[model samples]
Target: MPEPLTIMAVHAHPDDEAIGTGGILARYADEGVRTILVTCTGGELGEIADPSMATPETLGEVRERELRRACTILDVAHLELLGYRDSGMAGAEANQDPRSFAAADLDSAAGRLVELVRRHRPRVLVTYDDDGFYGHPDHIKANRITVRAFASAGDSSAYPDQGLEPWAPDKLYYTAISRSAMATFAERLSAHGINPPMSNEDGDVPPFGTPDELVTTTIDVGSAVERKRQSLWAHATQMGSNVFFARLPPPLFNELFGRESFQLVESRVATSLPEDDLLAGLRGVPGGQRHSPAR
Candidate 1:
């Protein structure tokens, strides 16, 4: 029998999945796509944004449960963990930990992800860009491993000891936060007489978010916004009162979170530009039609 259509999203932490790719995850799952989330770390050093939720020692355990709840809310078909520790923000002490995702051996981490890719046999793969979105150490590391897995998973010679069938995904995408969207959010915040978090004093755009032209696909998740929001709330230990997401009114929040964007970094199949759906070229496609992996 033909394999099920699948999407595998690799992330650095529990909540990272919600903020970046929750829309796509929920939207695709609703459409009967098999959504697989591979989180690389246990989020061991995450701060307790909700002090009443979890203590430092139990944060990891709490986060695992939270992530499970989020997966359920998003209707994800599978949730996998790479079992590495969180390497706290760039340059933080946690980066030195041998168990942290940032300190993990490249081939080893990529091997772990590659195993999942082969097992899941996804049609699409997603992760952060080279800059790792906002440059967190674990995020940067996650990007590296994901890129490596995307390139190596299909090669029978790669990680041969695994004994799993080689499976190459048809496309690879980088989840992106658009600069235009951020700027517009800033404008909306200003018009509402509320100060935007982490905004520069002079109203310059924040350091994160991709330029509009760089974004290759924008998926409107208006129908799945509730699931995404619930997924966010599931990570209660990470969602404190000061969070901009929680502070916004319902309508504004819905409007801002209604769509998600991605950059198509690699594709083995032919596709047109300005895509509105992630499965544009893959739907009804024959496996024989996909191009072989190119080095």
Candidate 2:
């Protein structure tokens, strides 16, 4: 039998996996891919959206437990944490803390991710763009380290002492929220007399979305939308029931999120744009396949 394909998604915090890549992860796992999640921080500084669970002292532990449940819902094959502290929103005091992920040394943080890349040997890696989606400090730091690790993990001379052989992923993708999607949501919000999140009073586009032209892949995860929703709901402390995502009717929610977008930052395989599958053109490439590690 051919080896199963593998995909690794590197995220900044616990809830991030659900918000951005939940659909893809659940769909690929269902299709027999070895899905791995590498979370950069403990999300210690995240706000508790649930009023009843607002114990700041235990938020980290609660969020960790929520993440585990979410991983299970998404059928993630492996979960790893880089063990860094959460650097709160940009300009927050946590950003000044040495232990926070945003404050960590770039080389050191990337080295930790390199170890996991070598061990998993995934054919694809999914991470944030240079802007880190919404530009949160930890998100930007996660993107920095992940980009570095993607390049360094393939170079044998780099981090040679990590005890794992160098393994290069066939493709690197940035999770994207496309401008088209944002526009559609904006229209819906305006129709309902609600202020959209993507615009200011001046009617100018915000920095939160990627240009539609930049999106190279759009995976149809319609079938996995329910699972994705369940995964997001698992992080109860981070998301409230009435938030934007939760408030959207099921049909509209699926319409917006059912098709996830990504920018193919780098690829070693031959593939065309607007791809419907993340593993497009990779199945037949030499050295592009991977097997699940033995139990």
Instruction: Give candidate 2 misplaced runs (Cα > 4 Å).
Output: 1-3, 192-194, 198-207, 288-295
Model 2 per-residue lDDT at 228: 92
Cα distance off (Å), candidate 1, residue 158: 0.6
Per-residue alpha-carbon lDDT of candidate 2 for residues 1-295, written as tens digits (9 for 90 to 100): 5546889999999989986899999999999889999999999988788658858788888888999999999999999989899999889999999999999999989999988989888889999999888889988988898888777787777898998878888889999988888878787766665566556886555655888899999898988998898898888886775466666666666766787899999877778887989999877565432322233
TM-score for each of the candidates: 0.95, 0.92
Model 1, 105-188: lDDT tens digits are 999999999999988889898999899988898888888998888888888888999999888888899998788777787888
Cα misplacement distance, residue 154 of candidate 1 (Å): 0.5
What is the clash count for each candidate, in the order shown?
Answer: 0, 0
Question: In model 1, which runs have C-alpha deviations exceeding 4 angstroms?
Answer: 288-295
| lDDT of each candidate versus the true structure | 0.87, 0.85
TM-score of 2: 0.92
Clash pairs of candidate 1? none
> What RMSD, rounded to one decimal, does every model reach?
1.7, 4.2
